[model samples]
Target: MARHNPSAPPESVISIIAPGMQIVGDCQTEGTLRVEGSVEGSIFAGKAVVVGEAGRVIGDITTQDAVISGRVAGNLVIGSRLELQSTSVVEGEVHARRIQVEEGTLLNGSVHIGETDGSTLTHEGQSDSEEQQLPIDAGSWHRPVVAAPKR
Candidate 1:
């Protein structure tokens, strides 16, 4: 039997929730999580979270960073940054250190940027990561093919 370390860093692990699959409970992970399906519960990611255009999430998301091109009907608590694609639809509050929303995106909630404690950053500097732009091509996410059952 192999031994597993619980406190190990997960920068190399990328978890994918493919299309046609539905998750009804909370998901917690230290690695990157890509959602191309539907999730009805909260998601807690330590690194980053990506929601493809075909995905739909009905619960909150807590992550260090996030990119959304789908529908999210819950609050977003992003520690680092949040990117909203043109096709993204978010219907809840958003709290992040930095945010970027492209044209055609639909957001129906309050946005709180800066810090979690409501204190604004008094510095006059911007990091390279903060100046990064959202990707121009996010509609090409893979969509799983589903075959009809034979009668």
Candidate 2:
């Protein structure tokens, strides 16, 4: 069943699963979620999902935004933005309108950025040459440093 937060606005909501907790069933919420524990099933949230350091998720996730600083081992679908912090680790497929991976983060799998419907969003770093060579092993992908064009 879907979980609703009555106090949350129609467009955004917030929920938290602190460290030490473990859930083994599907989670469906119409808001944001901050997880510091472990989940072994699918998660569906309307707004955003933050996975804290030390947290681990072993299932699919669907949300509008995601800020991960832990570990995820499943598919991820983000409608707006997906940010992977330096301490984050992900091993799965990703579909997002926008994606951000901080230096030192680890991701191992396929990634499809921008809207699948062919709409463009504000995106950086990803290139067509790179996209064609996706599903890159985490050991092979290197984050490039953009330098200012020399005059």
lDDT of all predictions, in order shown? 0.73, 0.72
Report the backbone clash tally of model 2: 0
lDDT of 1 by residue, 1-151 (tens): 1123566567547778899989998887767889999988778877888999999887778787999999887777788899999999887678789999998887766787887664332111122233322222224223331222334
Question: Which portions of model 1 show Cα errors greater than 4 Å?
Answer: 1-8, 118-151
Q: Output the lDDT of residue 123, model 1.
A: 16
Tens-place lDDT per residue, model 2, 1-151, is 2246677675565677878999898777766778899887778877778999988887777777899999887777777899999998887778888999898887766788886665332222122222421232334223432322334
Worst 10 residues of 1 by lDDT: 120-129
Model 1: lDDT equals 0.73
TM-score of candidate 2 relative to the true fold: 0.72
